[model samples]
Target: MTRDFDDDAPRRLQDAGGLINARRRDEAERIRARQRDDDERIYVVTTNLVIDAQEQLARRRRLDRIWRAGAALSWLSLLAAVIGTGIAWGTTGDLARFVVGYLICGGLFLMSLLTLVGVYFAGRNVSSLQRLEAHLASQQKALWQLKVKSNPDVDERGKLYREEVTTAIEYYQADSRKYRTIHNRHRRPRRLCGRCGQLKRIARNARDGQPDLCDGCYQGPDAICSICSRIRSCASRDEQGQPVCVTCYQRHRTGEPCARCGRTKAVNTRWPIGPVCVTCYTAVLRSPAECPRCGMVQPLIARDDDGAEVCGPCVGFAADYTCKQCGRAGNPHSRGRCAHCVLAERVNALLAGPDGTITPQLEPLAAALADAPSPFPAIQWLKESPNTKLLARLASEGHELSHELLDELPPNRNQRYIRRLLVHTGVLEERNEDLDRIPSWLEHELADKPTAHASLARPFLHWFLLRRARQRAAMRRHPACADRDLRRRVSVALDFLAWTDQRGLALADLAQEHIDDWIAGATSQRRYMIRYFLKWTTSRRLTRELTVPSIPSQEPQDLLDDDDRWRLLQRCLTDDALPPDVRAGGAITLLFGTSTERLCHLTPEHLKFDDEHAHLVLGRHPVLLPPRLAELLRQLAEQPQLRPQLSRAHPGPQWLFPGMVPGKPISTHGMTQKINRTASRSAPRATGRCPPSLLISPARSSPT
Candidate 1:
């Protein structure tokens, strides 16, 4: 039974194997059918994708054709406008009709230009579409590759095929998403023009991606400049400010260049040249001329042989004649004589007098005049009898011509003139007139004494005097020094020196006790002056180190209270009956806190006026003058006779407040006396105070 079962098993196994093989065949057929279905589906999807890509390519090509057609049409329109404008210009008989046709053709030409620009932008868009279509074509190629790679025969389980198909599908889906994103990004929304209110697609800013105005409104010629209100196409906002056209902006940037000297400086005035620099304008206003020979800009004093403008220096050197007697070079006078030779003849004629009688006084005077360096002094002496008499008196007294002698004379005009001539002639002794009043005892000590103490004291005295003289000169240059104060300082210095000498102490041996003793009995003014001298000596190492007693500080009294200042200012402004000098002086003093001494020294040259402002040069810096004060100063400057009427001396035109002495500003004492007198008359209420004199006290009392 087992043998029979075994033989039956082989047959059963064969039957079972056949049945299993048949089932496998059915499964293989089912798998092959599914593979065919998947291939068909893939082919269908790839065909649809390829068709879509082709459609996109066709659409891009159509856009390119449209762009090219629009560009051709724009060109044709431009050519047609040009031809029509030329025809209208050539055929029109009436000017009005021609102008109208020209305007129409010009408008057509501008529109055609705008159309060409739009077509160019459309071409760029078409290029972008072509790039997108090319990208889609590449995607279609990749999908075909994916389809070819996905073989159901090689991968019978279809795992790798399904994976590849899924990957390609995802890639195509991603490409579609990318295209949509690009399209949405490139597509701009339409915006209305701010100016014309026309709807148009605005281009986005590349940096911030914000929309900007349409080309028509942005480039319109109707835009106005904020500054000049001129219509222009090239208008833009400048420096975060208002919009300005190119012409107006250039005008603002480059101001008119100076016409004279060709400098790009601020224009002071307009001239035939165009504009002028302030320096050239001032020179022109002064009536200066350019010298043709030397090419120097100067006042026109003479003409050259060619009749061109020549400066004084050039004219002086161009003289044709030399003096016969003095051999000085100068232009020829009448009769071929130079100026010096002519003046020599005049001096000789004056020396002979009308009767040709030469007196004893006249003989020496004539000899001195003949021996003089220049003929000017002799000629000047001949013009004035007083000068001749003064020279005769000096010659008779056997005294050299000196300032001391001149100063000893009465402060008359003739004396002052002679003194100035002596100074100019270099015959006067050069010494400080203030130092002549030094104590005779001190002078004797410095000159006669030869002791160790005197040796040190002499040089110290000399240095002090030299320094004081320099200070006085500087103040006189400002014309602000007070002679009384200078004399007082000298007196104080002499007293201190004498006191120390009496104590048997040299400058090198000076101790604090001597300084303290000096300060013990001295007035505040004397103490102040002595302190200055000691400080100078210590600085120069002429004395041993010593402590100087500090003077007690005291507040200076106000010269003018607020009420007084108001009253004074009102009087200066309104009072016409008051003398102009007094009014002007009072105003300057009250306004600038200047004393009478400074006011007296003020000259017409000190006051400067321009178109916009007025200035008074009181010190180093110029003080601005108020309108009313400026007018008062102008009035004061205009009046040539501003000297006090009490004096008969000719003060000359140089002094604003002429003193009793000619050619000198008013003395500080004289100024004080005058102010006292004017104060009584001008401000009768302030009698005992002497408001004008009080002005000087405060200035003098204040520390320098």
Candidate 2:
């Protein structure tokens, strides 16, 4: 009996331990359940309120329908009165009877007008209900948040919603007072909506003595804006007594030349020097300049006793604009941080991963954007640009950013722009855009083509056109014409294939006569493009050897006379008002007969400086430059950059004429346009022989 008792005691002890753990787990689970209920209470209540509101709206809509039916009955009664009046005047021979009938008809008309007014009020109520329903449905989370923060239990409440919900919450809180005033549940609205005729809270315009308007009716006073020339809610009137929108009013009112930037803009502030625009005012306050008096970096407010620039403190005035974080003398952007600091924080936030650390891949791009000379534009771009959102999404998702990943996204201008920025900042490797875009373009073109046509055209493009293009792209930067040329060749080849297909003729069975017939029907330029496909197919033994006749060079029909040639040359040499690139490029075209395509490749190295003159290496031989032209070339070469901010970190060759894109020279088309703008007339192709007038000039003649 003692042995049995000992074993039972140990088993009972083990069971007791298991029960204690189970009880603890159950208690914890109940606590967690209570927490969950507390957390979800606001959302649950908000949902219930919305559902009740919707039900009440439906009941109100039913009432509006009944009102509409009564309005219809009123219109029918008015029509009956009109007919009765006509009958009384025609059938009633007595004047007294007819007059009485007319008076009764007039009373019916008055009643109908009153009914129409009721119908108008019903329609306005319907519109208001619809707007409120949409707002409630779309802003469910906002409603939940409002309820949480307005809870009476919490002693101190932090904001539970973003800035976007501030207005809505303010309006809701004002309306909430009506419910709180238990004695008067149906408070009268302050003002009626002018447009809708619904009674609601009134908000008055700050300026222009506009009418008092309810929230729904208030859009600002509509008038023809003088600057934009569109009827809109005018912000203010200009000096000419014409209405202007908010944007135009700010930009055009009290316009004056800014002393610092030398741009005519609306004066925001007055300095001793002159009127300053808002941009220049902010820039001057924020950017520290070297004070000549003390040789210290500070804002220049006043001149010293010696007539040299000095800091505000040097002149016994304390500085007002200074950053709190960095302690730099500059205008604060937000939270007492300067624009530069704000830009850095915003860039870091935009490029940070889900872990709140920037990826190694995106660090360079973030650095470039943060380190921009002007922070205002960068800040504006962050707020408005869709590209920033795309970058944010990519960073948050931790996606491996590459050219291939970017290509997978739908091809758009934004995608292309982002890719260019990434490539410029060394985040992505540089590749020829013209070459890379061809494959996608070809795929889109072939998507609707027949299988036979695609199969035939695919090999020709891959082996012949694309292969040659790849080789060209590898050698040098792709010319602007390369994309158009490749596309033209591909399109013509496809057309040739399609034409052959239509006639039920195979390439293997094709003859020279078929090629001739096809070329005969094509345009003049397409005739030359078809030769590429013929040569490739012949070499591949896909078709018989075909002879595509070469297009003979046509003589110039509009050659410039000697007077015109000299006049353009003189303008190129003497016109200081013309752009440096135009003057230099136009002069070279006239002298050496150099094509604009060749001029695009010319760099600073092409110009040789000597003791007396400058020589340009247009071809293998260098040509002498006139004194004025040489000075222009020297100035063009010495200038730092065409676009300093954009091309600051470009690693490409320094061309005589740089384009907007980093790491690229000016395109042939861009240079030609510049020349055309200056010359005022397009110069025809010159005859091979040099003009006698050019031959006499030492600058025009090529050196031995």
Say which candidate scores most in lDDT: 2
How big is the positional error of residue 106 in model 1, measured in Å on the Cα after superposition?
A: 99
Count of clashes, each model: 1, 0
Tell me the tens digit of each residue's lDDT in model 1 across 1-704. 33554658888999999999999999999999998899778878877777877776776777667667656666765676667667766898444655655566567557756765765765564446757667776776666566666654665536556765665566566789775554544575567755556776554322355336665656534577787877776556777666778676667765567755787876775543357677876554335456687776554445567765566568564323344555444333445555456655654555454345444434543444555444444455455557657654555454445565565665455675555444433345334433443333245434544465455455555576556666677656444343456555555666676777677777888778777777787545456577656777788888777777666766545445666666777887778877776677667666666655566778889999999999999888998998988998887777655321212223344777766443466665566556557764343221113443344224334443
lDDT of 2 by residue, 47-90 (tens): 77777667656766775676667677667667776677677668
Which ten residues in a row are the worst by lDDT in model 2? 695-704
**Model 1 regions lying over 4 Å from their true place:** 1-392, 398-421, 424-457, 468-487, 501-510, 536-542, 575-579, 594-598, 606-631, 640-653, 667-673, 680-704
Worst 10 residues of 1 by lDDT: 642-651
lDDT of each: 0.60, 0.71
Q: Which pairs of residues clash in candidate 2, taking residues 3 or more apart in a chain or in different chains? A: none
Q: Assess every candidate by TM-score.
A: 0.35, 0.58
In model 2, which regions exceed 4 Å deviation? 1-266, 272-287, 317-319, 325-337, 349-357, 374-397, 407-420, 430-437, 469-481, 595-597, 619-622, 640-650, 677-679, 682-704
